[model samples]
Target: MKRSKRLILLPHCVLNQNAVVRDLAREPGSLSGLVRVCLEEGLGMIQLPCPEFTYLGAERPPMDREEYNAVAFRQHCRRLFAPVLEQVTEYLARGYRIVGLVGIAASPSCGLFTTHFRSGEGPGRGVFMEEVLAALEGEGLSLPSLDVPLGYGVDAEETTAFLARFRAFCGGHP
Candidate 1:
């Protein structure tokens, strides 16, 4: 069997902007630029589940970390992410290099480096991301994770900057 050199864990919303709640989607459908970059780099990609979507669905109102950081929500995230962790571990065991994750900034669930809470955005980990990181730590695994802004359409220059950062994070070139 062929093995990929790297695996990229992406937030599901990156692949399906339409799945996001109202006024949250950035691109019309998918973040094609990022997707194309990943394909060009020959990186294997895994679209991680949207915890909010699984728990509340597409029509649910947007929430901040304060709203989604309940114990029940954390437990739900762990349960929802169990299979993903298993798959990542299996890939590692099979000699595939699991590179890192690309998360959405300001997301209450999947944000990697920055999250939204209490009507403000700040430097923090999202609930789902926290759970995933904990799981990875428990298994003695570490991977680089980067965050992109939430609304890709809000600013062209910001989007370009994000893409540049993402490319840099993916090993300096795309």
Candidate 2:
């Protein structure tokens, strides 16, 4: 049976074992085997960049606080989101159908629902996900997002599950 080509945008962190924002570069092998696996399973994978923080934007971890700098937070968000926007645009232009975007949950910059940030008193959601979702909506791009928890933590089984869900969504083309 021939499977349709389905596009999935994966966060670089999940794909790269040695990736960190300190250098702003990733190892060449980060996406090596993963890409082949995606193709073998009928996915046209697009590896997207993820931003890392040196210190969680606070003296202490933002997960310990409740809010973050509204202005700086948005700027940081742009850093993470802009590249994804460009990648998605290019994929669609190349006739690739986007099935969904996969990101790490609990990430201040990429969390789908519960990212943490430093509030004046404690920690809270940095609102990065909300902004990304809104931006996509404004641009008329409705892409489903999968928030894979860290418990999966780069497990091969988790990756397989992710690909399966991605393929299912692409099959529906919504």
Candidate 3:
């Protein structure tokens, strides 16, 4: 067997909708289109933990970034990402090229490019992503990342557009 030496980091919810908040999942189990595209492209994937789900549990309500923006939660994000960071580091050390991150667009805990707040949506990294990206940079591993709506798996046209951009930006040349 051979290896591609390429992979992307994904939020746990991307692979397990059961980890998402009530009535917010786009698919029954996984984001089928996204997963299918990844599989077709032969890109490896590393599903990162869902900070909110792990901390607040499946029954927890969706929260705004401000509400989740506490020192305690920040610390928790770092704690949860520690092992993931180790895994990322190990992969890099073994010569694997990182394809980057794919996160929920408006999630308070995992949004990469856009986040949610009481007032409305805003541009920023989520608590978990803030920690994860910083940790990766501390190790000199700055990778590309993007965010999509919670309903990313809903429409094919949007999915195609998003994936094209994602691949062009985050794929190739690692």
Which runs of model 1 end up more than 4 angstroms from their true locations? 1-3, 172-174
Write the residue-wise lDDT of candidate 1 on 1-174 in tens digits: 655568899989888987788987778999988887777777888888888998998899988999999999999999988999999999989788877888888888888888999868988999999999999999999899888786565788887888877777776473
**For model 2, how does the per-residue alpha-carbon lDDT over 1-174 read when each residue is reduced to its tens digit?**
754646777776557645534342223445444454556657766665544442252133334213543667667766677767887777778777877876655666566755544432222232565666776786789877776554342567766666556445545321
Task: Pull out the clashing pairs in model 3.
Answer: none
TM-score of 3: 0.92
Give the better candidate number (1 or 2) by TM-score. Answer: 1
> In model 2, what is the error at residue 49, expressed in angstroms?
2.3
lDDT of candidate 3 over 1-174, digit per residue (tens): 798888889999889999999988888999876787677667888999888888899999878999999999999999988998888889889999878788889888899888888887898878889888889888888887788765567777787777677656555322
lDDT of each: 0.86, 0.57, 0.83
Full ranking by TM-score: 1, 3, 2
RMSD of each predicted structure: 1.7, 6.3, 2.2
Model 1 residue 131 CA deviation (Å) reads 0.4
What TM-score does each of the candidates earn?
Answer: 0.93, 0.61, 0.92
The per-residue C-alpha lDDT of model 2 at residue 77 equals 65
